[model samples]
Target chain A: MSRSRIAFVTGADRGLGLGITKRLLELGWDVFAGSYLADWPELTELSQKEPERLHVIPLDVASDESVQAASRAVEATSGRVDVLINNAGIATHYPRTIHEEQVEEELLQIYNVNAVGPMRMAQSFVPLLRAGAGKRMCFVSSEAGSINRSFRDNWYGYCMSKTALNRGVQCLFDELRPEGFTFRLYHPGWVRSYMSGELNTDGDLNADDAARMAVAYFLRNRYEDQGMQEEDRLVMRDWLGREWPW
Target chain B: MDQIVLITEAHHPWGRALVREFAQKGWRVMACSPVSVEMFQDAFDTDRIHIFTMDMRSRESVQQAVERIQEQTSRVDLLVCGTLSSQGKESAGIANMSADLVLEDYQANALGPIRVIEACLPLMDHGLRRIALLSDVQGSLGLGLSGAGTGYAMSKAALHMAYTMLHGDLGRKGFTFRLFEPGPEPETEVSAEAAAAYFTGSREDEERMVMLDWRGQEVPL
Candidate 1:
């Protein structure tokens, strides 16, 4: 039990999750990097630089066994998780529609990884989260789930799965708020990730900007004397702190 | 040839009332209920009202129903998505809300409706087509009251966005969208006020496609 704050971030190999892991490390928190792929060059190189702080582990959010093992590994090494970021998700690219016969398969596959995956992570890592001081669970959801401000159609699987993910966050908040545990659902505003087809230049907020905002909000929620009110516990907000539609 | 209206979540009180109303108005009604079809067959005229078993969470079921409806009618004048989750009141607290249960809410409130809408689109090309979504004040982020049963509110909010996204292409195709909040008072049976509030707000024009309260007032999204 070193008093150092600890964070476990999924999808740490690249994109917003990786960016958030890096930022948390820079902020002096010991981070457990959970990546699906074993050999992500960036995570490997970064761990070498801060061996004691960043520990990369294999985690498949969709797998009960994988998440359980990852939880055990984190418990053995760090003993606690102050903040758990459920950021691992997959978006089936364009051409997904209810009319397509293949969309039924796509919806199930995407739902398993995107909607059910985070819930698995949350359930598996609860012990570690409860062991720490700030028991905050952050879900990296998306605007595609926004039923109020929906601007496009055709990506039925991605949109519905994210919507389901949002509901799961609400459930987590309902279940944990009484225990003084906090939850955050962040719509990481369009970052250049593998999903959005913006792998290069900035897509609205780059991965770093999105990650910085998300981590900042998490720290503020954790350390501030003015904790969230009862009604504010399970809210979906943009990276900039503006409340988003359910 | 009578005009056709399709209603989802017909097991709901409001949805059932709407089906009866449309049936009486001489419009052929296609009602899809998550429960048994027997609940609907005895009440309404079988000649004008058709009921089918459909679950919003399952895309396959919705597709099947849509295909069945297409066999009878070439176009649908109205598509009322009245699907909503009753699970919110059951899981009042944050901790009590399980992931599986919340996912069920999403399936009922958002995913199922979207599937129905998309499947019914081809038959929805009639000019001035009205798509009414029975939404709620709880889903509005501006109200900040959605924290209670987060799943219900989140699912409604997701449904709102899904329709709005459809507006870009669908609107241009002469489809108009409306989000209606049914308020707290459940009409044990349909009333004039309930119909007025749910179908038309301050204005009756098909062009008004924003969110409206049960009283027909525009709700800030």
Candidate 2:
């Protein structure tokens, strides 16, 4: 029998990261969940359920030392990572509007966690991803970043940081497509995550459902020759697999 | 009394031309940049123009400037933002530049403008408020992987999206958001003239959410 595929997820303490981790584990993949906190009730419970298959690692996406240490720990134990999901992000900087003074420092802090965090993960985990069978790196982004369709304003920090994240993902795709690496940016659909903080989501899907769709979509489409097509190089797909404009 | 227009990054050639264009048209022009007071006086008439020391990267400085403007006048008819970092020009490939540097570029190009626009929105509630963001064609998705300066292109592209969002949200509120691509070069003489004309002309519904070249020709969104 083939060995279980290994996956690494950031911000796995709760929300979409936790959902993705649970879904991946249910699918029989050994999961390395990265979180800033060492212990969470949900994570502890999950790890207890599948002690051998699930491993929780301390990670802080905003810090270089933390990311590097996490990468080294993963390399030491797992040796290979099939799917690397850059899902760690923060939306704490709220009340973004045109009338407020430019909160440059706060915006930078958001950019560090939301945009640069993904880039850092990608760089640190590329070796493991290349060694695994599933060469996919996914970024959890949002529709607020879409320039063509974005209508809601006043999310100055989140919106711009996500846009930068999308652009960074595109650059990564362009540079790594030839090497059989597939990159995707997914808008997990508005969920009741800690990030959104109850913002007008009457019909939004829950985190688990969105996560199931993510895993299904990746499994179905990751192996196809998407690199040959120019469009796949820079697509921000919805959970249902529809492309969102960058 | 003439209407007021606030232009950020006023030290640039295009920004200077915009200042002169609005000033010549007898509009009250307030130009903000990190440059010194003597530079503003050297280039334009201090009597016709108001210059403020502002840096897009600092919240305190931007807030002070916006408050000062609010104190002077309650309305700003036209807002033109010309702030963009030179890091993209100095960097090599996207892979080589540290993520922090790229974030810096986004801060200046994308976040700075959003903050400025948000701050100036209240002052624009009375009339046909217009926002023209001076971006680049390099920001267009059509460029794809063919372009260099990945950081700049990416941030400018983010700026493009910001303007699009503003257009959608403010279109009904008498706000006209335009992405003004003045080409990659710095020859502002012709484009600035066309842009001034476009900005001064009657508000056209079709121009909302539109990306226009210096000649006022619509570019693909």
Quick one: best DockQ, which candidate? 2
lDDT of 2 by residue, A1-246 (tens): 136899899989887789999999899999999977675688879999988999889999988788889989988887889889988877753655554455567777877888888888887888889889988888899887777676775776778778767877776777777788877688888776656434334548777887898777665564346445543556788977688876
Cα RMSD (angstroms) for every candidate in the order listed: 4.4, 3.4
What does candidate 2's lDDT look like per residue over B91-157, in tens digits?
4444565666666778788877877777778788876588888877666654454345556767777
Best by TM-score: 2
TM-score of chain A of 1: 0.91
Candidate 1 local distance difference test against the native: 0.73
**Runs of candidate 2 exceeding 4 Å displacement:** A1-4, A48-51, A92-108, A196-203, A222-233, B70-74, B87-94, B141-146, B215-217
Give the count of colliding residue pairs in each prediction: 13, 4
lDDT of 1 by residue, B138-186 (tens): 6665454534565566566566556666666677666677777766545
**lDDT, residue B102, candidate 1:** 51
